[model samples]
Target: MCLLLIAWKVHPTCPLIVAANRDEFYRRPTKPIHRWDDGSGIVGGRDLTSGGTWLGVTASGRFAAVTNVRDGKAEGTPPQSRGALPTGFLDSTATPQAYAAAADGDDFAGFNLLASDLDELFWVSNRFDGAGVAVEPGIHGLSNAQLDTPWPKVTAGKAALAAAVSEDSGAPDADVESYFELLHSTDPAPRADLPNTGVGVRREKQLSPLFVRTRFYGTRASTVLRVRSDGSFDLTERTFNSRRQTGETRIEETS
Candidate 1:
């Protein structure tokens, strides 16, 4: 996932709300959200190129998401894929802090990661010399730069998510579409607001919106996940191309 907006322990009846867009090349092979047949109890889209996931949640209420940091110097592939961060977390029994603390940040390119279990949320990043820090309750955002770095899209997403969660009823399906609408924005941030991430000005503007569109690469998926106070949850994932939505998957758990 390239942009992540999370509302943690903020809403009255909702404990967690996630709205994110996974920006990637159009030709990369990716499987939509699904239950892992490996019995890891993980449900998420798989990056077929790397055999890992960008975002996911386990049956035990563990959640994780990962985003790559935008650094021209770190453009080439590293020793490992960052997708393994979230997949590895869901596939293990370790707590968020423990998993983040033990992760070998140097093993991969610059990346930002979020890990959470039933109790708390944690964030770690190698680019900013980050460490495992427990996140407090409220809205938080992450993009290609760093966690809560206030990139235009990150700020917009964070506000939209907070509003959607605050206005929606407590039902599992309520406001799901609203969250998607929030993620579907295409407006680019103004020039002054765009972050100079080594990518040129034109390229930066192209990638500034909540959703991005380019011929070779863009946002391939927009996903919204809501986990209620009782542990019941719902996740909706929409797959896209350069033009329109190709498919959508909705998974719900009442328990």
Candidate 2:
């Protein structure tokens, strides 16, 4: 996912709320949100390219997501592979911080990694400048820029999404499902002066379903994760297969 916004324990009304857009090839392999073994479940789209997922949460309250580093080519050496960091470790493991900190000796840059388990959330970005300051639990926003950055889209979107969840009165699953649509929407109306509207994407479809007709190499998906203070998590995925509605998964027992 290129964009991710999450509201963590800081909120008084809602414990956790996430909205993200997964950008990947149309053919990437990913299953819709569903209950899985080990009592772990996935609610976000997985990376078909590397099997790493953009954003998702485990039933036990672990969460993670990542966005690309948007910048022009630089003068320095670039990484051997864009998929160097194992972001897949976020949702699948418990000791994510220890796992990531172990990669300090390894070369890293060009990608961002965010992860959260039962108690905390953390972020990592390997770039020429350096990895970013680690992030802690609290509402956070991330985009192509960096973690907890004040970029307009990341900052503004986080606030708006948080407000949406706070004001919601219905079931969190329904309210958060609606919030997914808000994040997944990318209305592609043409711009008069800009020609291409400056919007990198041509159309927005759920589940990496939309085809741009160019080798179909693109990212398209959205995942919403909801976690309550009582130690329960839910993941809902909206993909090409399930256009508007999301496939739901209950991680830990809420009842």
Candidate 3:
């Protein structure tokens, strides 16, 4: 997941709201969101190349997501796939903090990970110094960089998510299409607002939008997940090929 917008414990009826986009090369092999048949009780899209998932939720009320850090530097090869970080947390019985704190960041490339056990949420990053920190209740955004780094897309996404949540206040469920609409915005940021993470201005501008598109690489999935106050959840994932929508899957589960 490249762009993750979260409204945690902010809404009256919904405790957790997530809107995210997974950006990757078009050639990568991926399977859309589905329950794992391996008896893990996990639901998420699978990275066929790595045998891991970028975002997932378990029937036991666990949630996890990951984003790679883009510094445009050559790190040769990392020992592990960042996708495994999230997969590990969802498959574990440990608390969010314990799992995050025990992670061996050196094994994987630079990444930011979010893990939640429904009662609490924690974030860990290999590129940062801390082990894991508890997330406060509110609207937040995360991109390739650290959490809430104020990039153009991150700021815009947070505002959009806040409005979506506010507009759906007192309702039992959020409007998933509104979140998808925001994720589909293709407007690029102004040159002055772009972040230079070693990528040149041209590439930076290309990746500035909430939704990114290029000749060979772009956003492939847009997912919206809401966890209600009663411990039920609604998850929707829309898959894309280039700029065209290819398929969609929605899942609802009651506690």
Over 1-255, each residue of candidate 3 has an lDDT whose tens digit, in order, gives 789999988988878889999999999999999989998888999999999999999878889999999999989688889989989999989999999999998899999999998799898998987999899999999999999999999999999999888887534454567889999999999999999999899999999999988999999999998887777788899998875999999888787
lDDT of 3: 0.91
RMSD of each: 1.1, 5.8, 1.2
Candidate 2 at 252: error in angstroms?
Answer: 7.3
Q: Which runs in model 2 stand beyond 4 Å of their true positions?
A: 35-44, 74-96, 104-109, 128-132, 136-138, 150-152, 169-174, 187-219, 241-255
Compared to the true structure, candidate 2 yields what TM-score?
0.68
Q: Please give the distance, in angstroms, between residue 75's alpha carbon in candidate 1 and its true position after superposition.
A: 4.2
Those runs of model 3 whose alpha carbons end farther than 4 Å from true positions after fitting are 169-174
Could you estimate the TM-score for every candidate?
0.97, 0.68, 0.97
The number of the candidate with the highest lDDT is: 3
Q: Residue 175, candidate 1: how far off, in angstroms? A: 3.5
Compared with the true structure, the alpha-carbon lDDT of candidate 2 equals 0.54
